[model samples]
Target: MDGVTVIDHPLVQHKLTIMRKKETSTAGFRRLLREISMLLCYEVTRDLELTMETIETPLVEMQAPIVEGKKLVFASILRAGNGLLEGMLELVPSARVSHIGVYRDHETLQPVEYYFKAPEDIAERLIIIVDPMLATGNSSIAAVDKLKERGAHNIRFLCLLAAPEGIKNFQSVHPDVKIYTASIDSHLNELGYIVPGLGDAGDRMYGTK
Candidate 1:
């Protein structure tokens, strides 16, 4: 809670409720996720630095403010993260995109890395890592581990829902990185799913299992 930001917007809350409903269809869940992700992106990037630059309007030349520094990288955490990526890209079309593929080992509940790709100058840019559900935080923590190993410094983690246990686990390992989310649910169940969560994000979004 200290370093985490809760979006708490009315629309975000409404969409989240719809998503949590077991009866919601795959198309409906994915659509709500996209809309919510866009709002989440808006809040996460709120403090980005801007610089004044000379610009010419149709009638006159003037100075205008524009975002400074290199384009941000939205580092999505595999298949589920891609859902959030869709909405975030809609907001920042010029931003760079990266993927870190990690999966949970069913027995151990540890993160397993399968793929990773990013810009060459990742260290010089602000990177926002996204995963829809921070159920265990293993994937998010491990994904950030890979990024730090590759020289990324400024990083932020965003998600649709977070469990208290997951937040504790993630912040314990990576305290410096900021976390943004729409809701902080009660707790994770025995099966590693967030209680009162929207269920398995990938499964719901893809109509799988």
Candidate 2:
């Protein structure tokens, strides 16, 4: 867990509990995810470098701090990752957006990419990959692998809930990328769902089967 940071803020914990409940409605679940995404954005960008700039207030001239470099890129992991994307954009409206669609191949238990689109200069921007669940880590790993192949060097992974096995597998393969999650749930079940996880995140958010 060296590179993993759990967002344990009181508000974050309370919101996550509401999200985990079996009875939460789709509208309510989506609202909570947006709010939580804003909160998580605060922590993840805490250490971003800033540079001082000359500026003028209404009455006088002064220097101000601004984030360094071009806007960041949020690489969402397909359908579910878009849930988190909605809120992160609230904080950084100018940041670039990328989408990666990957699904697990049941028989081989491996990740297969179906879609991928991103900024041409992906190698030059910091990328934050958002996905709701990190169950087996196969998809996350595969997504990161694809990004690295495209020349992305600085990358991070964020999720709402994760399992220890998933985290271990992710870190073992991508140790340089830090992981941020709200909760580390119990182990995954035989079918690959994280035990006690908030069900399928995409399904719950969309009220789909």
Candidate 3:
């Protein structure tokens, strides 16, 4: 719980409520996803390092503090994460992007990584991994594993919602990495879906079902 930050902002909660409705339209869902992500990004990046520099305003020169170092890497955890990535990019236009794809096997309840690509110098920049739901957390853990293999150390995991089990699992695996979520649900269902969750994030986002 120490490293996990839950964003309870009213705008975020309102958008999440819209997203959770079973009758919400595809267009509405998509738009809300972007809006909620932007809201969450505001909190996620609140502590970014700042460096002071002299800048010329319209009337005079003044010292200002701007975000330091190379822009952060917004790493999407595959297809669903893409939704959150779009909004985060709107907030941090200069941030680099990356992707990691993982699918769950129903029978085995295991995560299968199908794709991964990241910036060559991930270690030199902050990395924020975005995914809408953290249910069982297998895919998230696996995604971070791949990132670590590529030398990414300063990493954060951001999601729209999470289950307590998923949070504990992620923390146990990567205690150093902070987590940010819009909400934390009660538990995961028998099928490994978060109870009362917005349902399959990829399916809902793409209108696949």
Candidate 4:
């Protein structure tokens, strides 16, 4: 994929395998998601611009590098995205947060937006949209649509799993935004679920059907 980056870190891959197992408990699934998300966050922000700042060393004064520009904005796509958001926050506690409430309509597989909130200076920050699964891509695309309407231009999308169909669909709509994921599964099933993917992430994490 031209605009996609697959996080193949060994720890991430190992944890994802356990999360995919049907017998894994909800607690286990949620724990692994949080743990893996930090690793994903590491790669996603690897290229962040940096600026040198004056700092005091044990023996002398020196210039140290720090992240440049405004703090990042992690735009979570409702409930499931919060799983990834939790760990990313642990890694980047200073970053800002944004919540975008969008869900896939079971019948139409379209996105329905219910809530949205973000920092007033969102347009000046790098927004990273978090979601567990990019199965049909409707919800992610819609969330981006909403963010762009608010003047967000520097944006990235992060997810635990993605389907080829979903990637194609998302790229078609937002080619400028890059995507980061733990894995790209085979395909989407008829019900808009990623094939060979960990089951509905929200259901697994929350112990719901």
Candidate 5:
């Protein structure tokens, strides 16, 4: 909990509840995810550095605050991470995008990376990794490892739901990166899935399963 921030806005909670229902249609789930992600994005980037820029209003000249430094990078962890990416991009249209393809080996529950593409100047900007569920934390950790190997120093992890086990594992490996989630669930089930979770986010998002 030391490095975690929970987005408990009423709208976020309400949307999450709808998403958690098994009867929810794929279209509904995707819509709520995008809506709630925008809210979560608001909280994750709350502390971004700001610099005032002088601008002339119709009435008079004024200084307005704008984000400082390079555009933030949203590094999505394969398929499911892309769900959060849409709404986040809607909020920060100028943010750069990174895609890291990593998947869990169902048997071993270990991560395997097959694809990765990111901006060349990743080291110069903030990277926020998005994944819907931080269940075992293996894939998330591997994704962060890939980013750090590419010289990313400042990083954060954002997810729709997190398990205590996954949170502990992630922090143990990458304590420097903070975590942002809409909810910290009860625990992970034996199959490496979050209990009472919204089911396979990638499947639910795309109507695959």
Candidate 6:
């Protein structure tokens, strides 16, 4: 798909394997999510525009490359997205952070927006929405919808793991938004969880289970 980038880098694949194991500990899972997020950020930001500038490097004045245009905005789909946000921020420290809160309704199977707050100049910046799991893709879609409503035009979605069904649904709805993921699994289970998935990312990250 034009908008989908499956990150199969060795480090990403290795960490994903550890994350998929049933025996992975809570702390280990949390740490792996951060490490993988950093790797994903590298792939996601690969095409970022850079411009050369003259700078002095102690001995001589030389041209150095610097990021061009507006800084990126990292919009996290809480609270699972928070886990990935830390690592992404480490790589793009100057990137602004935004929060989009959405929860899946158990009865209706729909996303409910509880809280959504983004940068004022979202339309002028590239916004990367982070979430660990993309099973049903309800929340991610809704998050993007909200961002668009708030005038965000350039946006991308990043995740650690995703299901085929979720990817299809997301692509069908928002074909223009690029999606980057570490792994793509089979399908969502009967209970709407991604099969062979790393379980509930929020719970595993916080040790709430």
C-alpha lDDT of candidate 4 relative to the true structure:
0.96
Clashing pairs in 4: none
Every model's TM-score: 0.98, 0.97, 0.98, 0.99, 0.99, 0.97
All candidates' lDDT scores? Answer: 0.95, 0.93, 0.93, 0.96, 0.95, 0.91
The 10-residue segment with the lowest total lDDT in model 4: 200-209
Model 2, residue 9: distance off in Å is 0.7
Per-residue lDDT tens digits for candidate 5, residues 9-124, read 99999999999999999999999989988999999999999999999999999999989999999999989999999999999999999999999998899999999999999999
> Global CA lDDT of candidate 1, please?
0.95
Writing each residue's lDDT as its tens digit, candidate 4 over 83-193 gives 999999999999999999999998999999999999999999999999999999999999999999999999999999999999999999999999999999999999999
Candidate 4 Cα RMSD after full superposition onto the native fold (Å): 0.6
Write one digit per residue (lDDT tens) for candidate 1, span 1-209. Answer: 69999999999999999999999999999999899999999999999999999999999999999999999999999889999999999999999999999999878899999999999999999999999989899999999999999999999999999999999999999999999999999999988999999888999998887
The true-versus-predicted C-alpha distance at residue 24 of model 1, in Å, is 0.7
Which model is ahead, 1 or 6, in terms of TM-score? 1
Per-prediction CA RMSD (Å): 0.7, 1.0, 0.8, 0.6, 0.7, 1.0
Question: What's the TM for model 1?
Answer: 0.98
Please give the range of 10 consecutive residues that has the lowest summed lDDT in model 6: 103-112
**Residue 124's lDDT in candidate 5:** 100
Best-performing candidate as measured by lDDT: 4
Which runs in model 5 stand beyond 4 Å of their true positions?
none
- Ranked by lDDT, the better of candidates 5 and 6 is 5
Q: What is the TM-score (0 to 1) of candidate 4?
A: 0.99
Error of 5 at 74 (Å): 0.5
Q: How many clashing pairs does model 6 include? A: 0
